[model samples]
Target: MDFKEKFSTIKKHLLTGTSHMIPFIVAGGILFSLAVMLNPEGAATPETGWLGDLASIGSAGLTLFVPVLGGYIAYSIADKPGLAPGMIGAYLASQVGAGFLGGIVAGFIAGYVVKALKKIKLPISLKSLGSIFLYPLFGTLITGGIIVWVIGTPISAIMEGLTGWLNSLSDAGKVPLASILGAMTAFDMGGPINKVATLFAQTQVDTLPYLMGGSRSSYLYTTNWNGNCNIVSSKKI
Candidate 1:
């Protein structure tokens, strides 16, 4: 296809692709967030209560099975042609903790890569080469490599580093930190403040798991107390 034609096709794909995935993204994110809220190690852990079960279910939807969402999105953009490999690509991305971002990236990569692969001109009969070894071979290698080496590793590092820093703060610092997070969350109605607190909590989860017996509960309690303080600050306003 000519440049104009390719641009038009790509534009059409982008619109269709984004439209297909947006709902899943929103739903999955909401479900994941709700799961986190319900699972808070507060009055009851997610292991027992009704809310805990509900949270588990929601979290399960986005867990290792997230490829289904990416697959469907690709199917919407590239039709039936994109479904199989799109799922494959998404599964690989999720393995490295890319979560939703990985899923979306995989969907776009699989759809467009397959679309472009189909358009490649060759002297040999594409019918034989195309199905036999083209799409799966090239698509999987490219998408998998990009995610494993380029995208996934660096993002995972940042996530790890952020969590590490939060865990390193002294005990006295936690409540203040949590308070700041709570204030931020409540102030923005759960946008920025929620992010800060959630980041700290996630960090705690990673690091506090190593604490023996009593230290675990104590550390968790302080963080929650601080978070409540921040929320109270917002309420006071």
Candidate 2:
């Protein structure tokens, strides 16, 4: 593929992953938020009774979404053979604190790895075994090793640095951050760009309430109000 075609294919893969990943994010995010909201102690993370259970279940779903994203992206790229390696790599990525970004990397790696493996000149007798066994085995080995040993630590450090920086931001710094998130939220309502921003903010929701509370949702409220006012102004008798 040429540059444009390759870019488009990659974009399609991302969108495919994002599309499949959305349900988990939405469901998990809502339940997690509700659990926190209903927590009597007002703890940022609840840890007792049904609320705790709810939170845990929601958190589990949140955690699984990354793997799902990775698996589906690979599935988009190289079909079913890529799913296992992608998910395994992504799960390792999560364990190593590499997060969704790492999951994306893992997906692409697994997909391409599986695709390349498919090109090998295997005997007809071994073709079936290769599909189920060899592809996932080597793909997972390669993808998981790279994630856990090489990229994992750097990705974790980058994420930690970003979180720390956000936390350290004063009101002035927060303004730009909020505006950027707000603009992303309003850009296409809930399209891919908005979801990308939402995914990032959602990941931080447990620790950064202001990102979701003030920056994203409230901005949408204001936009809707302004839009309503414009509609009123534009109406003529």
Candidate 3:
């Protein structure tokens, strides 16, 4: 394929991960919201009650989303062998405060690294070991090394800056920002722009619900609308 085609494939890989991530976002977000709703004072998350338990479960889901996104994106590129390395890298990304953008970077790196590794010629006996042993081991090491040593610090700094900026925006500033995200959603449907917007919003979901609140409403509307379009297209009507 041409470079354009190759580049465009990244969108498919991204969407693959994003699609897998939605259920986690939706389910966890609802549970967490419920827990917050039950507390009258909104002082802090209940630590002992069922609400606490629910919040914990939701928090787990939110925590894993970065890994899931990385895992599935690599899986799209390099199949089963890439899954472990991608998740490992993404988990490292989160630990370093790299956010979803870092997760995406981790996924792509793991995928391509694994893909390149698969090209190494091996003896018949050793070839059999590539899938179960060599791939995961080397893949994790190289990918994780890049994350922990190379990109981790810079990416973390960027995420911190982004978080600070998002927090600093006044409520009025949010409307234009939310409107732009909506416009991107409508303009691209489920394309790369939409994916980027969704990832940006998702990164803030746990710490800042109101930001995601705006994205979520538009997301639901677009989802239903897209479903209807799919049905119509299927019917050729």
Candidate 4:
């Protein structure tokens, strides 16, 4: 395939994963927002009350965010065979503090690994075993191993470094940074460009709230503008 075709294919796969992940993010975000709204004092311990319960549920959903994303991405690439290993690898990525970017990497790894596994020939009787046992077993082992031992530490360090750099930015620098992110996010609605900005913000939410805030504002602004344009065009008819 040519470069554009290859990029389109990759974008499609990424969007497939992202589309599946949106519901989880929305649900978790609502619950999290409600939890904080209901317990703004930050005293909502796990055993406290419904507020704490809401927080826990929200936290749980968010925790699954990365694994689901990775699994679905793999599914987009290699169908059902890729799902289990992708999720496992993604979980390892999260455990190692690799975040959303790592989850994306894990998804690609698991998908390709399963695809490669499918190419191996086996005896008639062994074929059944290969599908049911061997593929998942080895796929998980290899993908998880690479994610945890080889790539995880370096990715974690990079994420940390990015977080620190963002945190240390001066007020003047922050305005420009936010402006750039906002423009990127608002450029294409929910297209690949928008997703890139969103994924970055999601990964850094705990460490860099400002980026998320800026992106959200920009998204809202662009969405409103589109809605107004639609309304105006309708009135002209």
Query: What are the RMSD figures for all models against the true structure?
Result: 11.2, 5.3, 5.6, 5.2
lDDT of each: 0.55, 0.79, 0.80, 0.78
Candidate with the larger lDDT of 2 and 3: 3
lDDT of candidate 3 over 6-97, digit per residue (tens): 87898789888888887888788778878888976684666768888998988888888899999999999999999999999999999998
- Candidate 3 residue 39 C-alpha distance from true site, Å: 1.4
| Whole-model lDDT, model 4 | 0.78
TM-score (C-alpha) between model 4 and the true structure? 0.82
- Please tell me which predicted candidate would have the highest TM-score against the true structure: 3
Question: Which candidate would rank higher by TM-score, 1 or 2?
Answer: 2
Clashing pairs in 4: none
* TM values, all candidates: 0.46, 0.82, 0.86, 0.82
Candidate 1 wrong stretches, greater than 4 Å: 1-45, 49-52, 64-69, 120-134, 157-237
The TM-score-based order of candidates, best leading, equals 3, 4, 2, 1
Comparing 2 and 4 on lDDT, the stronger one: 2
In candidate 2, stretches whose alpha carbon ends up further than 4 angstroms from where it belongs are 170-176, 185-196, 213-237
- lDDT of candidate 2? 0.79
Ranking by lDDT: 3, 2, 4, 1
lDDT by residue (tens digit), candidate 2, 134-157: 998898899888999899889888
Candidate 4 stretches with Cα past 4 Å from truth are 40-47, 170-177, 188-191, 205-210, 217-237
